[model samples]
Target: MGQLRDRLMRRWTTARWTRRLGAGAAIALMVLSIQPGLGNVTHAKGATVNLVMWQQWGGGHEKKTLDKYIGLFNKSHPGIHVSEVAVTDNTKIVSAISGGKPPDLMDLGTTGTLGQWAHDGLLQPLDTYIHSSHINMGAFVPAGWHAVQYNGHYYGVPFMNFNVGLVYNKKLFRAAHITHPPRTLQELDTDAARLTVIKHGRIVRLGFVPDYPASNLEVFAWLFGGDWFKNNGRTSTAALSANIRALQWEQSFYQKYGRSSVKRFVAGFGQYLTAADGFESGKVAMMLDGEWNIAFVKENVKRFQIGAAPFPAPAGMTSRNGTSYIDTNPQVIPTGSPHAAQAFEFIKWETTNPALAAEYATLVVNLPQLKHVPQTSLFKDPNFRVFENEANGPNAHQLPQTAISSQFATNLGNAEEAAILGKSSARSALQNLQKMTQQEIASTH
Candidate 1:
C-alpha cells in the first residue's frame, strides 16, 4: 500500500514471541490501568460498543482517510465507537493476540500472511457472521474475496485491493513511432528495443524492466498460465513448465542488455514515489505497476501522458490478455476479541455500505473491493477505469492461500531475482524454489 513494503516478514521464533509477549502483557496491563472501560459493553440494546483498532499503515492520507471513516461510522452507528491506534510493528499485534488482549478490530495490512495467521488460530473465522448478517458474498471482487479465504473459510474482509498492469509513457511511445501498448511478449521485446536509448554503451533510458519497482514473478507467471501451488493448495508447483518459461522470459532482458550495464542503469533510479522515479521521470518507458501509479504520475510528472494496459500476454495466449496479479489490504478480528459481534458489525458496515465504501475508496484512490465500484462515477478517470476493469476481469488471480505463504512469496521472489540476474539458470532456480517451498510447507505444520 506504500512505496515499499512497510516491514519485512519476521521468523516465528519462540524467543521473539517471548519478548513480544512480555511487552504485550505490559501494554495490556497499562491500558487496563489507564482506561478501565476499553472493552465492549453488554449486548443489550442501545449499549455502546467501544472498539480499539490497531492499523498497519498510517500518518498521511491513510490516517486521514481512516479517521474520516471512523468519524462517519461512529456518528451513524451511535452504539459503536471506534478508537484507532497507528501500529507499525506487526510483532506487537502477534504479542497482543498471544497475550489474549488483542484489539477488537485489526487491519492486517498485507494479504501474504492471512492464511498463516488463520491457520495459527490468530484470527476469527467469519463464515458464520457473514451468513447471519446476510452479507452479499458476490459483491466483492473475486480475487480480493479469495485473498481473505483459507481452508474453506473466510478470515477477513478486503479493505482495498490492487491489480498491476503495463504502465507506459505515451510520449516515449510516440517518439519510438509505436502507436499502442504491446499486446504480446514478442511485440513487447520489439517495442522495448525501439524505445530503449543507449549512449556510449550505457543505458540512458530503459524500455522496460520486469523486476524493477517490485518482485513480479507472480505477475509474469500468471500471465504465462503458471502458478506456485496446486492440489487445492496442498503442494508447490514452482517448477511447472510455465513458470520456467516465465523465468527465461525475464532473463532475456538481462541477457539482451548486459546484466552489469542494466544494473548500473537501474542503480541511478530515484526512490519510488519521488520526482526522479524511473517511470515518473521518463527514464524508463514502461514497467509492471499497480493502479496507484496513475495518481502518482499525475502528481509528479508534468510532461508525459501515462497510459495503462494489461501486460502483454505470452505469444498465442490471447485469452490471457487481461490477466493480472491481485492482492489486498485485509481487515480481521483477532481470535480472542471480546467485541467480536460489534466488530463484525463495524467491518460489514465499512466494507459493504456502498456510500461509505465509495467515499473511502475515492479518498484513498484504491480499487474498491466491491463490484459496484466500477459502475460509479467516482473513478471515471481513464487510468482508474482500466484497473477497475482488470480487477473484475475473469483472468485476475491471487497467490495461493497457505500457512507458508510468507515463505513462498520470499522464496519465489528470490528465485525470480536469481534467474533475472543470471545467478542461476531458470530451470535450476525454479527447481530449487520448488524444493524450498515444499520444505516450508512441510515445516509449517
Candidate 2:
C-alpha cells in the first residue's frame, strides 16, 4: 500500500512539471514574436523624455514647415520625442501656465512679450542653459539678442529674425520716370507725390503708403530717432520730440491725400495674403513690409518685377541710413516645464545647426537668427538678398524691451491712426499716448 501511494505522488509531480515547461515555452515564443516591435516604440525603456512644443504659427505653410523640421529632430534624437501643439492665442498659453499644464517649449511670436512674462516670474532665465550648452551668444544678431534679453538675463532663444524693407514695383517706378529708389524719407515723399495718379476727380493709384499691409509705429519712430521708452526702458518716451516728428510725418501722407480718400482706398484693398493685395494688384506702387512679402509676391503675384530696398531714413539723419526694424519669434521654456533641459537641447539644435537653421529660414521666408546661416545660397537669392543685407547692416534696431511693449505698440498705433485721420494733432495724440504708457508702466511695477 505504501509503494502504491508513493507512485501516485510521483505521477502528480511529473504532471505539474510538464505543465510548467509547456507554459514557459509558450511565454518564450510570445516574447520572441514581440521583439521586432520594441524598436518601433518611441518611448520604450531607456532614458526617454517626451516634450511638448507650443507655437502660434497655425497657418498651413508655416505649420507644415515647422512639422517637417520637428520630425527630423525626432528622428535624429531617439531619446527625446517632441509633440507640437498650435496654440494660436497668447491668452491660452497664459491660462495653461496658470493651470500648471504649460508646454515644455513655446515659440512666442515676438520677444516683445518676454519682458512682461519675465517680470511676472512666468519665464525661466536661460542663462544657465545658454552657458552649459556652450552656445555662443555672439553668433546671434545683435537685434535678436537684444530682443531676447530682459533685466540683464536671457529668457529665450531667437529662432528667426525679420526686418521691414521698402518693397516696390519696378514697373511702377519706370512708368513714373523714376530711375532709382529713394534713399531718404524726403526723397520718398517726393517720389510718392510724383508717382501718384489722379483721374476724373478721383485718386486712382498711390505711389507709396506708409501704413499699408500694417502699421509699423516702432519702425517709423526709430527712423525718427525716437522710441517708446527711456532710461533703460523704465520711463515712457512716447511723447518725445522724435516720436512727434515721426507721427507728423505719417500724418502728412494722409493730409496730402485726403484722409477720407486714403481710408476709402485702404478699405477697398484686399487681404495681404491673397492675389488681390493692393501692392501686388498695381493699386499701390510701394509698401513698407517684411521679407515674407517676397514669398507672397512670388506665389501670388507673378506678373510684375518686384524690388526691395532699405527703408529710407530721415534726410540728414545719415546715422539712420540703411535702418531697419527687426523682430523675432523666440523659443522659450516656461517656468514650470518639466522638460526644461530637454527643451533647451532642441533649441540648441535648431539654433546652432546650420543646415536646420537655413532650412527653417528658407521654409518660412524669414531671416535666420544665426549669423552664419544668412550667408547660405537660399538667403542670397535676388528676391531675398535685400532683406538679408538690411538685416546684417549696422542700423538694424529691435523694439524696446519693455514689459508693456505690446501695450505701448497698441497705444502708438491708436495715436497714429487718430493723427493720420486728422482727428487729433500729432502733439495731442502723442501726449495722450505718453500718459497712457506711463500709467501702464507704473501699474506693471
**Candidate closest to the true structure, highest lDDT:** 1
The TM-score values for the models, in the order shown, are 0.84, 0.83
Q: What lDDT tens digits, residue by residue, belong to model 2 across residues 1-445?
A: 4533543464357665575456457557453221111111223345667778888763467788888988988999998988787776666676456434567888997776788888877789999999999998888777787888988998898888888888898999999999989999999999998889878868889988778988877778888898767788878778888888998998899989989998888788888766787898888888888887766677677776888887888888967866677888888999757568889999998887767778878877888887776356665687688888878777777766778766776787899899998889999999999899888888988
User: lDDT per prediction?
Assistant: 0.80, 0.79
Task: Show model 2 residue runs off by greater than 4 Å.
Answer: 1-48, 198-204
For candidate 1, the 10 contiguous residues with the lowest summed lDDT are 1-10
Clashes of each: 0, 0
Task: Evaluate residue 348 in candidate 2 and report its C-alpha lDDT on the 0 to 100 scale.
Answer: 91
lDDT for predicted candidate 2 compared with the true structure: 0.79
Q: Candidate 1 residues 358-432, lDDT tens each?
A: 777776667887877534564777877777778778778877789887678778888988888889999999999
